[model samples]
Target: MYAIIQKFHSGWAYIALLVLVIAVVNAILGMASKKEFTAKDRKIALFGLIVTHIQLLIGLVLYFVSPLGLASLGQMSDKSLRLTSLEHPFVVIIAIILITIGWSKHKKLTTDESKFKTFSIFYGLGLVLILSRLPWSLWF
Candidate 1:
């Protein structure tokens, strides 16, 4: 069960990150071009939002079940353990929160520029944060 969930989480990370990058790039492009926010743009962002949320749910379950997750919390002195146990999960959660905020805030925005700007700032920050804290050693 642990191995299965771990593999799924690792595999899903790619999809989540890819979608997020696409969303961020789309928003940045839209903002730069001053393009009107259309249904297609909203759907792109929404897909990113949904995918990340699903990844978060899977990660949460893995965190509780994997030995390297919550189980290794007490071994914070070990850098690798520290990352899987605390840093990775915590930072990822924060990133997801920022993404969610971007989604919610965009809904309340009136201008296409404001919506694109909000997504660019929030989702871009979220992507950066997630990338920064990733267990790169494990991935490779």
Candidate 2:
């Protein structure tokens, strides 16, 4: 069960990251070109949100079940164990919250530019945070 969940988490990370990157790039382009926020644009953002949320759920479950996750929390002196057990999960959760907030804020905005800007800043920041803390050795 742990291996299955771990593999799912690893595989899903690729899709989640890719969708997030696409959404961020799309928002940046929209903001730069001063384009109206169409349904397609909204869909792109929504897809990104959905994938990320799914990834988060999977990650949460994995954290509880995997030995390298919560089980290794006390091994703080070991950099790799500390990262997988604590820092990675914590940072990813914060990033997801930021992405969620960006999505919510975009909905309340009245202007196309405001929506694009909101997504750009929030999603972009979230992406950066995720990238910074990702366990590259494990993933690769």
Candidate 3:
């Protein structure tokens, strides 16, 4: 069970990250060009949100099953363990919340520029947070 979930978590990471990158780039372009936030733009943002939510779900389950997750909660002395055990999950949760907030905020905005700026600032920061805590050494 742990192995399967771990594999899912690992594989989904690529898809989630790709979608997030696309969303961020799209937002940046929209902001720079002052483009209208059309259906296509909204769909792109939705896609990014969907992917991250899936990742969060997978990670949540993995947290309970993986030894490196809850099982290693007390082994904070080791950096890598510290990451997978606590820092990664905590930071990722915060990042996911930020991405969700960005999506929500975009909907409340009337201006195209405001939509772009909200996504640019919020989703971009979420991406940075995810990148900061990713288990790089274990990824490969």
Candidate 4:
């Protein structure tokens, strides 16, 4: 089960990240081109939101099952354990929340430029946050 979930999280992460990048880029390009918001734009953003949410759920479940997760909590002396147990998860959760807020705010936006700008700032920041805390050594 651990192997299965670990694999799922590992693979799904790529999809989630890719979609997020696409959405951010699309929003930026749309704003730059001054194009009216379209259904396809909404779908692109929705796809990113959905994939990110899925990844978060998978990660939450894996946190409980992985030894490096809950089991390593309070072991702050060990850098790697500290990261996987607390820092990585905490930062990623914050990033996801930012992305969620960005999506919600985009819906309330009245202008095409405003919507894209919101996504560009918020989603872009979220992606950066997630990238910042990833446990590169363990992941590698």
Q: lDDT for each of the candidates?
A: 0.96, 0.96, 0.96, 0.90
The local distance difference test score of model 4 is 0.90
Worst 10 residues of 3 by lDDT: 35-44
Summing lDDT over every window of 10 consecutive residues in candidate 1, give the lowest-scoring window.
Answer: 68-77
Candidate 1 runs further than 4 Å off: none
Q: Which residue pairs show collisions in model 3?
A: none
Order candidates by lDDT, high to low.
1, 2, 3, 4
Report the lDDT of model 4 for residue 73. Answer: 99
| Model 1 Cα lDDT, one tens digit per residue, 7-104 | 99999999999999999999999999999999999999999999999999999999999999998999989999999999999999999999999999
TM-score of candidate 3 on Cα atoms, chains taken together: 0.99
Candidate 4 lDDT over residue span 1-140, tens digit each: 88899889989998999999999999889889999888899898888889989999999999999998998898999999999999989999999999999999988999988988888888888889988988888667
lDDT of 3 by residue, 1-140 (tens): 99999999999999999999999999999999998888988999999999999999999999999999999999999999999999999999999999999999888899999999999998999999999999999997
The parts of candidate 3 lying over 4 Å away from their true place are none
Cα error, candidate 3, residue 66 (Å): 0.3
Better of 3 and 4 by TM-score: 3
